[model samples]
Target: MTCTKIAYVVAGTISIFLGVLAFHVYEVYNQDDPDVFPHNLFFPLWFSMDWPSQRTYPFPDHIQYVDRQYYAEILRNPDYAQKLRDENAQYQILDRLFRLKIIRDKFGIPLTLTLDESDTFSMWVEPKYPTFHGIDVGIGKKDGRLYVLYNWHIHSVNLFEDINGMIADIGSQFDSMVCSDKPTVVDGDLVTIDLLLPSSLNDPNKVAEKCGDREYRMCVQGTYHLHNTSGSPVGVLGYTGVIDFTHLGINRGFRVKSLQLKTTENGKRVLYKLN
Candidate 1:
């Protein structure tokens, strides 16, 4: 082959090699999974990228020495030593990180809430056929007062087959008075009446006397109320609740409507209805 032809062949080979290398690099960087790259290649890259040199804590050696001394003290305590041994392996790794201050000081982001500026409402219900039983609402001071509003529902069903109207007759009283009274104000916070629907609807003696030996599922729905004793308008900051599903089995839950506190022009606090 002529020298010029040979040079052209070599250039073609080099171009193909470069294209394959570029494709591999792109796959390593753009893939959804971080483990796309082999550990040997990934660890160096990750360490260099997140080395924390710019924000390195001073006296790391001293910190390590202190941590070792404290760990030695823990080892001297038989109970603590046994506890450490009983910990899971992953927890042990986290404990080491905490000792080194890597997972402690470096990741110590405190969450704070200013109660005076924030308001919240929450409900806790029994884990039964219907998830709601009671609720609690809190309205934070705006101008000087707080306000809250809520609603809920309750339901009961007789599971036993009705034969000769016997079971139906017994279960009929399950719908008797469940929840009553408006929300009451206590210490400037509006609180709901704690209602346990299951206890009332599923009473064994009552069910036997009224509906015979039968199964009944009960649920509750209603609105909780709040009072603003602070004399100022209130604003809600966050709302949360603990839901119980132990009795109802899986995939059953409760829903609540949005509640808010608003100030009227005359500085009166009232429940804000959503449009």
Candidate 2:
């Protein structure tokens, strides 16, 4: 072939190579794109402590804390970051309710009690004690009597079919509490406790045996809520609660299970398992 013809062939090959390279780059960028929500869709603007300048459109402080923590996790593993973000958005309204103390005072339960982690599972019984990590509390009025609702988020634990058993066990304890009338049961995919108290709430450990074992074991996610008779949400509370089972002779257990709550200074979320 002539020199000019050879040059023409080389140019064609280079053009095709550049086009393929550009397509690959576009694909990679699309895969990692952070705008999961549609542009026109309305997502509430939340303030972040990490981004204080956005104060004009600030997320609730609790939400800020959670967002920072989850986004940090995105840096390490982008696979589940969007899932976390979607869940966080659903939790924002509830977090604000607890943060502003609306639910606490409404039910005459203190905010400290809801966020308390010292009492393990006893918070379900003793109103004065702090709430366990996975439990969220709120009050609703039905038929002119005050009713308390307990929302528990059991996550990452291996309860399997035993989850229903554990919740039923917990429900039974609530049913035994001193009440003027029978406790109303509002069972769901998640656990919801509604008890009408005649006097002060009391502790029941009837299911202590089910708290942990080789067959049934679990921990709580940090965010949960309460709903009213019409199924309207009452409030949301966020806190980390992990139950240690090593003392119970369980070889596989979570030493430190951190959910939506901040788990690291750098903002990365973590779930530490001890086996």
Which candidate achieves the best TM-score against the true structure?
1
**Tens digits of lDDT, candidate 2, 33-83:** 443222111111221221211112122222222233423543655443233
Q: How close is candidate 2 to the true structure, as a TM-score?
A: 0.16
What C-alpha lDDT values do all the predictions have? Answer: 0.29, 0.32
Regions of candidate 1 where Cα sits further than 4 Å from its true position: 1-123, 130-256
RMSD of 1: 31.2
In terms of lDDT, the best-performing candidate is 2
TM-score of each predicted structure versus truth: 0.17, 0.16
Residue 161 of model 2: what lDDT?
36
Those runs of model 2 whose alpha carbons end farther than 4 Å from true positions after fitting are 1-167, 174-220, 223-275
Model 1's lDDT to the true fold?
Answer: 0.29
- Backbone collisions counted per model: 23, 6
Q: Model 1: per-residue lDDT, tens digit, 1-275?
A: 99999899879866865575455555455556534323111101011111111112122122221133433544565463223222322232222223332223423322121233233222221211111222222222233333333222122222322331443344444544543344444445444332222224323344223311212211222222222333232233122111122311221222111222232324433333210
